[model samples]
Target chain A: AQSVTQLDSQVPVFEEAPVELRCNYSSSVSVYLFWYVQYPNQGLQLLLKYLSGSTLVKGINGFEAEFNKSQTSFHLRKPSVHISDTAEYFCAVSDYGSGNTGKLIFGQGTTLQVKP
Target chain B: DTAVSQTPKYLVTQMGNDKSIKCEQNLGHDTMYWYKQDSKKFLKIMFSYNNKELIINETVPNRFSPKSPDKAHLNLHINSLELGDSAVYFCASSQRTGNEKLFFGSGTQLSVL
Candidate 1:
């Protein structure tokens, strides 16, 4: 079974400050990693994903994440945050071996709070 | 235009009632999925379809069923809804294969009273 763990449940940051949301996963085979953002009362929006080729992946709204195979981690980061960046972020994984069903397993989620 | 859309953004019904949530995607993707977000904000995959064929059906109760008329549309029907059935259901779609990112609909907030 594949599972994702988001170390922090909530993160509070000041506007224009840098932030990082930690995510780690455990899976027997290869997997695809993703970050999704959910605004207030809205569905999840794909922020970015790591399939292969590069360790660092860039996403919308100046967000980026790096995949560390050895560490089994995919941590999202931003150099600076804005009030609009505040939202719930989820880390998900899909095992490459599950074929088409490879349903995504999401973490508990981290709520980003940006204060002005 | 919205890549994915679900009807009845908010659903409020009495217990033991039945309801259905409709979802349509115009992204021309061949894969669709249904997910449930509980009150605690834990997102769980309920079903998945590829080319209108069932691909994944989690351990969801028999009370929940999904229908996909075509590759672009996947609908969810709930039977004899209970208070525990209240949740936010999201419809998502992605390309058939290879590193694809899912596009999700606004979601249907079902509240069983």
Candidate 2:
């Protein structure tokens, strides 16, 4: 079974401040990590995904994440955040094994509230 | 243009009712999926179809059934809806191989009264 855990349910930060949303996963098979953002009343939009190679991956809106294998974690980070960045973020895991169709298991989601 | 679209963006029905949520994707992907986001904001895969063939069922309840008329369309039908059935149902499509990112619809917010 594949599962993802978002440690923080809600994160409040000031504008222009750095922020990190922690995520951890557990899977018997190889897994692909992804960060999806959901604006108010909207569906999830893909932020970035870590498939292979470098441990650090960059995504849209100046966001990035580093995948730590030994720690079993993929934490999302941003050097600076804007008011527009306030939204709900979800950490998801997908089975990367061959012949496996795309089935994404998502975490509970963390609400990022950026204050001016 | 909307890459993926679902009809009846909001659904409010009484308990024990039967309803259906229709989804269509124009991205020309061969695989589509249905996901349910519960009140707690946990997104779970309900079903998946590749080339209009069932690929994953995820042990969803028999009350929930999915139909894929073609690769571009996948519809979900619910029977005997209960209060616990209220959720946001998302329709997504993808290449089914080599890629993991999915194009998702706005979702149907179903509220069973």
- What is the per-residue lDDT of model 2 for residues B1-113, given as tens digits with 9 covering 90 to 100? 89989988999999999999999999989999899999998899899999999988988889999999999999999999999999999999987643568888999999999
How well is each residue in A3-46 modelled by candidate 2, as lDDT tens digits? 89999999999999999999999998888999999998888899
Candidate 2: TM-score of chain A is 0.97
Could you tell me the TM-score of candidate 1?
Answer: 0.97
Range of the 10 consecutive residues with the lowest summed lDDT in candidate 2 chain A: A94-103
Docking class of 2: medium
Deviating ranges (above 4 Å) for candidate 2? B97-99
Candidate lDDT (C-alpha), each: 0.94, 0.93
Write model 1 residue lDDT over A1-116, tens digit each, in one string: 88999999999999999999999999999999999999998889999999999999999999999999999999999999999999999999987774646588999999999999
True contacts kept of 1: 0.63
Looking at model 1, the pairs that clash are none
The regions of model 1 sitting more than 4 angstroms off are A98-100, B97-99
Q: What is the lDDT of residue A101 in candidate 2?
A: 72
List CA RMSD, all candidates.
1.1, 1.0
| DockQ for candidate 2, C-alpha atoms | 0.69
